[model samples]
Target: MRVAYYCQHVLGMGHFFRSLEIAKALADHEVDLISGGPEVRAELPPHVSLFRLPGLMMNDDFSELYPLEPGRSLEEVKNERARLLSERFLLFSPDLFLVELFPFGRNQFSFELLPLLQDIRDGHFGPVKVVCSLRDILVEKSNQEKYEARVVKRLNEFFNLLAVHADPALLRLDETFGSLDRVRIPVRYTGFVTTKPRSGAGIALRRELGLEPSQKLIVASIGGGKVGGRLLFAALQAFARLGLSGARMHVFSGPYMEASEFLALEKLASAIPGVILEHFTDRFLDYLDAADLSLSQAGYNTAMNILATGVPALVWPFDQNHEQRLRAEKLKQLGVLGILEDADLESERLAVRMAQAMEAGRRSGPAPVDLDGAANTARLLQDLAS
Candidate 1:
């Protein structure tokens, strides 16, 4: 079974990371991972080949963007590199082609995927099951319900299936899809996808994070390498706001961050006692396991890991983006978390909310969110392969 996964991120590693995780589960099958976003550090298992595209990613405030090279002309780039990469990517001839998020977001790069999806749909390519992978929420700017309806409906028609990685009961903030519950295509609530508890490495990670016998640590991480800079800043602010002098703040600024940016954050961490701001680490889930509370932006990856850890968190979904705000509200309503919006972000408020979130997090435990997602997703692809 050969599966071709297409994920492009301009700023962060959420989509690519999720696809890589899913790809690992299908290690027995041949895999081709393709990207157009700026380069990121991705470790793929055997049988997984990677394809890089034309542009190099630049980290702007919102997310990653691929600007044309310093000397290369845009026209030349389009005439040469883009054309070649697109042709090369098609050579894979995958049995199952998965489109991550573009059906709903990222219309600009539609050219990279449109030809492929069209070919598969038209039988130009061999029989392929095309699926659209959706994170729990489609972050939007405002209540652009009218514009969103068009996109969601088009996405529904464009693919054979919709795989939502979030448990809606935990956060049914999918205004776009929630209304289409009666649609014919299967809306598989595949649950949250997360890195499993690796036996050998997890213990060391916990120890390194300074989890005492029962310190009740709270780990706050933004998603991979982009878009969560403000969230990390907010976390630092939250620590100071909440006056968490005793609690350990393990802030993971993804490794892809600029040296100057990271050093600046490091300075902030130094001034604040009990704050350990560092670069990316492998023990994401383990830190969650050892944590008493978690703080982060509402990216699907971080949310899934938090759920997997079965600990509590104070999640402040991104404010500028409407998608995360809705997601944060949904998860909060499900009793899986507590939230502070970007509008409500401040040091004092964050400190108070962090305390409340910690208290709220401990009340009962992780409410039922999807945990069997990775296996279920793997099964879906395996069946498609067959």
Candidate 2:
């Protein structure tokens, strides 16, 4: 079966990577992956092909839309993207057309997505199975009820399935999108989509990085580096206060952090004996596996990685959107992670949590949450195709 997977990641790399994981899981079949965002380096499996469209990114607060290209008009770019998307939908003629986030999120790309859906509804792409590949939690809108009503209208008209990459035991759709019953389509829980580490990858990486046995390893990161400066900044202060504690810190400030902030972190790390700072690494999960503890933002991909590794973690959820807050709360309730409040991001408060996390040591044993989402998503796609 041929599948066309569309994903647009505006702020972070989470959506792109999650979509990639599902595409990899369906590696037994032909997959055409469509990405409509700024370029990112990602490893793709043999069965997948990529079709990158003209990119768009939102401002920091998601208040405005802009073209990724310098000095280009947003309308021109949007038109081009819409044209390309329509062309691809017709050419690929996929048995299944999977969209990462729509109606629920990525409403910015409605110019293209709505048209694509119309084509499917009009049978331009005959008998194609349309699905929404959504993350576990959704961001609550300002006017949620009206927003959901519009979403329900779209889903009932165009979508055949809703593939939620979450375990119902942990969180259900209704918890976030309260109008769940109005979706009017089949919803399938595909476990918690996460990539499992390779056997002995942690041990191998430790040896490669020359980490000593007696030294405690701490991995700190901010996904995509768009808005994690506060958390990353606080961590630096916390680590500095706990100096010479035999703990080696590795910090990934994220790829999109401002130059000023990243430079500050670099200078700070240079003065610190055991702290190493870098911009980004694709081997993020491996680093988490090698760490005694993880300090990071509570994004979907990072949280799932923390859970899969069963590493003791301290997370500061992005309070602006209830998405991260809800996810962090649920995971904290499950005992996999500890929360660091927005009120207490200062060095003194974080140092206390840091010390406590270090003293607790590695969290050994199997993870309590399901990690079979990638595989299960593939199984469902096959079922839908049949």
Candidate 3:
């Protein structure tokens, strides 16, 4: 089977990573992973090929779109991107079209997406099984009724199925999108998509770091780093205040964090002993497995990583929407993790929380929700193609 997976990440890298995991799982199929956001570095499996469109990204607040390259007008980039995307679809002639967060999110790219979808429906790209890949929770729109209606119309008109990458036991699509009954298509819950750490990777990493059994390893990160400066700064300050002897804290500020903010974090981290700072790491899951405590935001990918590793985590949910907070609260109820409040950002308070979380240790037994979303997504797509 041939699959063309379309993913557009405007602000954060969570969407792209999740989509990539699913594509990796589809090793039996020929996959063209189409990405049109800021370039992200990743290692692809032999069966997967990446097709890049002209870069377009959103501002922090998602108020407007801009081209990644300088001196290129937004209109020019959009036109070129649309043309390239259409040409790619016609050339690839994929049996299935896996679109990430279209009607449920990333509506800004409708200038290209709507036209492409319409073309597919008109037989321009041959017989294509159009599917939507969505996350668990959705950000509340200002006009939710209109938003949902538009989504239902589009899904019914163009999409063949809606594959939500979330464990229904943890969260269902209808919980966030209220009008699920109106949509006339199959909607399957494929669990939560995430990459699993290698067997014994944590134990090996801990030994490589030359850490004593008594010493604690704390891992801190902000997904994509575009808006997590405060979380990283707070974590560093709290780690300094904790002053635990021999304990090490490794902080990844994410690749997209502003240079000034990263430089500030670098200076602050330099003043503290046993603290290491890096921009990003491919071994994040392995580090989480080795850590006694994890500190970060409650984004989709990070939450899934924590679940996969069972690391004791303290997460600061993104305040702009209820998506992160909703997921965080659910995990909190399951005793899998703890949530961070505004007041917790204070150095003393956060230090206390960190100590408590580390003392509590890793989660016991298996995770409460399903963690096989990537595999299940591949199976579903293959079955559909068959």
Candidate 4:
């Protein structure tokens, strides 16, 4: 089967990574992964091919859309992207058309997506089954009834399946988006999508970093570094205040952090003994596996990694949306980690929480929740195709 996967990551790289994992799982089939974010280095599996569109990104607040290339009009880029996307559909004629965060979110790209959907609905691309690939939690909007009606109309008209990447026992779609009963489509939970930790990867990494037996290691990251300036800054102050004996810290400020904010962290890290500053890494899960404690924002990918590695962590949900906060609160109830409220994001509060989390001890292994989403998704697609 041939799968055409469309993913547009406006503010962070989480969506791209999640989409890539699912594509990788379908290694036995032909896959064309279409991305509309600024180019970033990534690794895709053998059966997967990339189709990059003109890059468009959102501002920090997600209010404005702009091209990654300056001097290009947003209208022109949208038109070109729509044309390219339609061409891919005609050429590939995929068995499955999978879209990430559509109708429900990424509504900003409706200019292109709506046209593509119309083309598909008109039978221009014959008999392609459409699916919506959604994360566990959704951001609730005001006047949700009207918004949900639009989504239900679209999904019922164009989409065949809603593959929600989560465990319903832990969190169901209705918990966040209340109008699921009104939607007339088959919805299934594929469980949380994340990479499994390789055996001994953490031990090997610890040896490579020359971490001593007696030293305590803390791994900190800001997913994509788009809005973690406050968390990273507060972390530095908290690290200074703790000054735990034989404690070492490694911070990945994320690749998209502003240059000035990262430089400030670089200088600060230089002054602090046993502290290291770096950018993003593909081995993020390994770092989590090696850590005695983890600190970061609550994102779908990061949260899944922490769960897979059973790494005790301190997570601050990004406040612009309720998704992360709801996720954090649920996981906190499970006693898997600690939460630092946005209202209490001071150095002192962070330091206190970090210390408490570290004392809670590392999780022995992956959480009991479902973690076979990638493989399960591949099977589901194949079954649907058959």
Candidate 5:
């Protein structure tokens, strides 16, 4: 079987990363990936092929924004992508064509998916099942509740299934969208998408960074290029003030962080006895494994990674939108994460939160959240193809 997977995400690597996991699950099938976002270095399984759309990103300048990237709009780039895909779609026509959460997300850009879905439904396209895959939450941003209901209706009519890759035991994000039709599809809560670690691996990424056994590790990450220096600086201050003696810290300031700014942070770390700061390294999770605590802006992929790693982290969420803060609240309520608002987060308070969480973490284990979904998700996709 061959499957076509589509995703267009901006700012964070969550969408792409999740899609990658699904693609990995279907390694036996011929899968084609259609993505639109800033370029990222991801290890694609050998069976999957990539089709890059016009590089797209969210336009923070305007409200209700998903601006076309410069040098080429994803629309124009999408044309070439579509042209290339149309041929392959007809030739390798698969059992399913799965869209990752935004036959509704593009909002403005989804004008293309409807026609494609119509073709599939009307039998104009090859024999295929179209599925809409969504993550646990959908922070319904721009569209009015009524409009989303309409979109759900449209999706229900066109797609074969609405796969909610999250546990129903978790909170329902559909309430926020209020689309009975969309919610009513052959909806399957496939559990959360978390990458399982290679078990029994005790590789200490902290020791790799030259930290001693006595020092505590703090693995901090800001996704590749889009981190706020001011926000991160505040977290660093917190780490510093927390003042755990002989603690060794490792900071990953993503690719986009300014070199000059990072150099300053590195210098600051050097002054400290055991703190270390470096540009974002490819060894992200390894460092995560080595750390006693983690600190990052709350993003879906980052949050999932932390949870999957089962480490206690202080999530200092961005004030960009309420969704991040909302999740932060949920994690805080669960006592799985510590929260610090952007405006109010200080190094001193952060230090207190971290010191407390880590000291407590030593005694207790990760919360009783079941992440057995990835394997189940693999089985489901495999069954779909079969």
Candidate 6:
């Protein structure tokens, strides 16, 4: 089977990474991943190929769309994207169309997506199984009733299935979207999609870092780094205050952090000993596995990584929406991680929390939530195709 996966990440890289994991899991099928957000560095599997659309992203506030290429008007980019998407649909003629966070989210791209969905509905791409790949929680909209109605209408009209990438035991689509019963389609929970780190990778990494058994290794990161400067800066300050002997901290500022913010973080980190800062790394999971403690935002991908590695984590949920906070609260109840509050950002308080989290050590035993979402998603798509 050939799968054409459409993913548009306007603000963060979480959606892209999660979609990539699912594509990787579909090794038995050929995958054409359509992406239009800011370019990200990743290693694609042999069976998966990326189809880049003219870059389009949201403003910091996510109020409007802008072209990534300078001097190109938003209208020009949208027109080109629409044309390319239709052309690709005809060329690939994929058996499955896996759309990430559409109807549920990424409604900004409706000018392109709605047309493509319409074309597929008209049998322009032959018989294709249309699936909506959604995350666990949704950001509350300005008019939720209208939003739910629109989603139900779109899903029923164009989509064949709704594959929510969450463990229903932890979160269900209806919990966030109230009109689930109104949608006339199959909605399957494919667990939480994440790539598990290689076996013993963390242990090997710890040894390679030449760390003593007594020394603590803390890993800190901000997903995409566009809005995580506060958390990273605060974490660095807290680390400095900890003053723990033989402790090492690795901070990934994320690839998208503004240069000014990253430079500021670099300057601050340079003053502290045993602190290493980098823009990004492909071996994020390995580092998480090797870490004694993890500090970061509570996005779906990061939360899944913490769960996959069983690392003791302290997450500062994104304040703009209830998505991260709600997920973090669930993990907290499961004793899988701790949440960070605004007052906790104070260096002194954060330092204390850091110490306590490290002292508590890595989470032990099995993960409370299902972590086989990537493979399960592949299986579901394949079964549907069959």
For each candidate, what TM-score against the reference?
0.82, 0.97, 0.99, 0.97, 0.87, 0.99
Per-residue alpha-carbon lDDT of model 6 for 1-386, expressed as tens digits? Answer: 99999999988899999999999999988999999999999999999999999999898878999998999999999999999999998999899999998988888899999998998899887899899999999989999999999999999999999998888888988888999999899989999999898999999999999988888899999989888789889999999998889999999999889999889899999999999999999999999999999999999999999999999899999998899999999889999999999999999999999999988888778788889999999999989999
Runs in model 4 lying further than 4 Å from the true structure: none
- lDDT at position 280, candidate 3: 89
Q: Model 2, which residues run further than 4 Å from truth? A: none
Write down the RMSD of candidate 2 (Cα, Å).
Answer: 1.2
Candidate 4 per-residue lDDT over residues 305-381, each given as its tens digit:
99999988989888898999999898888888788877557878788888888888887754868988888888888
Candidate no. 4 TM-score: 0.97
lDDT tens per residue, model 2, 108-183: 8899999889988899888999999998988878898889998889889989999999989998988988888877
The candidate 5 region of ten consecutive residues with least summed lDDT is 59-68
Error of 1 at 151 (Å): 4.3
Clashes of 2: 0
Best by lDDT: 3
Candidate RMSDs in Å, in order, are 3.7, 1.2, 0.7, 1.4, 3.0, 0.8
Considering TM-score, which of the candidate structures 2 and 5 is the better prediction for this target?
2
Please identify model 5 stretches exceeding 4 Å from their true place: 61-70, 73-75, 181-184, 200-202, 225-228, 243-245, 257-275, 362-367
User: In candidate 3, what are the lDDT values of residues 26-55, reduced to their tens digit?
Assistant: 999999999999888789999999999999
lDDT of 5 at 374: 55
Clashing pairs in 1: 10-64, 11-63, 11-64, 38-57, 139-323, 140-322, 140-323, 217-292, 241-347, 242-351
**After best superposition, candidate 1 residue 378: deviation in angstroms?**
2.0
For residues 1-386, could you state the per-residue lDDT of candidate 1 as single tens digits? 77777877766778788878877877778988877766767677888888877764544644434454778765565455456654764688787777787667776665546665666677876688877777777655345666566566666656777777766566553564445654456777777777765554444765775556445466777776455677677778777666544677888988677788888888888997788777876667777766777878877777777666666787767655566777667667767777766665676777777777676655344436666667778887677557
